[model samples]
Target: MTKSKTFWAASALISLALMVFAGYSIYGRVALHFSGDTIEVKPVPLPAAEEQEEEKVDTKSALEKIKAAEKEDKEEEAKAGRGTPAKTEVPRMRAVKTAFEYKDSAAKSVLISGSFTSWKDKKMTKKDGVWKTDIYILPGTYPYHYTVDGKKKLAPGKPKAPTGDSLVTVN
Candidate 1:
């Protein structure tokens, strides 16, 4: 009888856990449905039949004015080089491929932060004790640095920083 009671208690606990999980899933689905963009519509009763007739009369007058303006637009398009290509020229921008590398054997995380990346920390992956990452940026000069293990520093043999940041130029 003691063994049967133990078995029944275990079964009850498992059943309660399953019920709680199912209830949580249902609550999450209901919360998600109401959380995102929702449109609520309350039915507004239409105007009386006599008031609706007045609206129809005003619409008929407005329709005539719209049709007359459309006819004028058709006439202007016929004279405005309708089938010819437009003479406007669009300016083009090019993207440049650049590689930023840092050689640190003991650093836990190496990041490349620059103007192209909005000066944000972009973590680089380590390979054979050297951290490297490639970035595609626009053709321009950008000043940047390598943040190694939470310290802001530059790579070896870099030029002196007037802006306290090393420059990388892309042409």
Candidate 2:
């Protein structure tokens, strides 16, 4: 090949390779950001059986204290001739079927947790490179996130929560 043609071809190849490398780098960064690599997960140990029993006893005592206080309030109201307070009906909130999804083809397990689940991890089913779960939730906003392979990850494109987690709203 002519020196000029050979030089031109080499330059073109180099340019193409540079472009490919830049494109791959950008893709990797975007993927890592959306995949929740920035979020950290810390495992909390469960309470022991003895501690659970103690908590039950404490709950019983707390309930008894509340009942006693209510009785005292009623007695005082009776003495003041206020009679019994009329019961007001509180409207019940209907639960909406909400779907949560996380995409991670490499993940072996995915779980979702939030105020709705009492912060307990709920397992998600995987299908076609997506992990998903449906939960019946009352109409409200709740902070939540996904646990992919035991690491906390927020759902991509979702709003951020005050606690630095992802937010989900059910209506």
Q: What TM-score goes with each of the models? A: 0.48, 0.48
Worst-scoring 10-residue span by lDDT in model 2: 36-45
lDDT of each: 0.76, 0.82
In angstroms, the error of model 1 at 135 is 1.0
For candidate 1, lDDT tens digit of each residue in 60-153? 9898897787667776777785764334365788888888889889999999987678667898999999899999987766667899888999
Report the lDDT tens digits of candidate 2 across residue range 1-171.
Answer: 699999999999999999999999888755744654333333345767998899999999998998798788888888999968556476898999999888889999999988678678999999999998999987877778898888999989998864668877666
lDDT of 1 at 153: 95
**lDDT comparing candidate 1 with the true structure:** 0.76
